[model samples]
Target: MADRDLRDCFLNTLHGKAVDKVPVLSVTQTGTVELMKKSGAAWPEAHFDAEKMADLALSAHTIAGLEAVRYPFCLTVLSEALGCRVNPGR
Candidate 1:
């Protein structure tokens, strides 16, 4: 499964159903510094900008072969949601 095409496999795995292969999923995939530079979507900016966040979040799917991507990126997202400032860097 290659990220965008693994929706059914992911859902099936969650439902305790068997799949051809285990879906490679992650809610905490880090966007490397190189990826940020390549995509022009820095972490600090991405945290606040939806487009930047989406671009950075898709890096893993496009480059790493993740079976799925956590939309808007899911790194410590709750902290921001709970009114805490997220510090820059991985």
Candidate 2:
């Protein structure tokens, strides 16, 4: 069977559909120092900027050869939104 699209592969797997292969996904922060330099989608800024975050997440698939992408580089966003002080370390 042919491989499904990346999104479909992920969804199908969740729904217990038969897929040719399960997608290798990070499901969280997938960035690495190496991936940052290679894809030019580094951290710090990417964590805050939606565009940069998307770019960095996509790099997991495009550059790191992962089958899927996930977003929000860190958990600080939730804490910040809940009025918890966030440091956003440099």
Candidate 3:
């Protein structure tokens, strides 16, 4: 915990090591309508625009002080690439 970064905090938990305090992180996806409004990174657009997607991702940390950032906006990102039709759930 002494001068530990987020990676340290997360890795420590996975490895059964000690943390001074539990880091703020989500066990699930962090995207939500409230976060979209707060960060001005709504869906549909964020689904396609990397910058918008990044804004939404960072909101979890910037607004809630999470120790980590979740990178995927949708679970279907690779669906289209894998021969499935993907539609934006705006």
Candidate with top TM-score is 3
Model 2, residue pairs in steric clash: none
Q: Largest lDDT belongs to which candidate?
A: 3
TM-score of 3: 0.81
The true-versus-predicted C-alpha distance at residue 61 of model 2, in Å, is 1.6
Model 1 score (lDDT): 0.74
How many clashes in each candidate?
Answer: 1, 0, 0
- Tens-digit per-residue lDDT, 3-90, candidate 2: 3577788788999999887878776668888888877767788887777888888888888778867778777778988999887777
lDDT on C-alpha atoms for all candidate structures: 0.74, 0.79, 0.82
A best-first ranking of the candidates according to their lDDT comes to 3, 2, 1
Residue 80 C-alpha lDDT in model 2: 82
Instruction: Work out the TM-score per prediction.
Output: 0.65, 0.78, 0.81
Candidate achieving higher lDDT, 1 or 3: 3
Model 3 lDDT, residue 13, Cα: 83
Write model 3 residue lDDT over 9-83, tens digit each, in one string. 878988999977688778568888999999999888887889999999999988877888887866786787799
- Where is model 1 more than 4 Å wrong at Cα? 1-5, 71-77, 85-90
- Lowest lDDT 10-residue stretch of candidate 2: 1-10
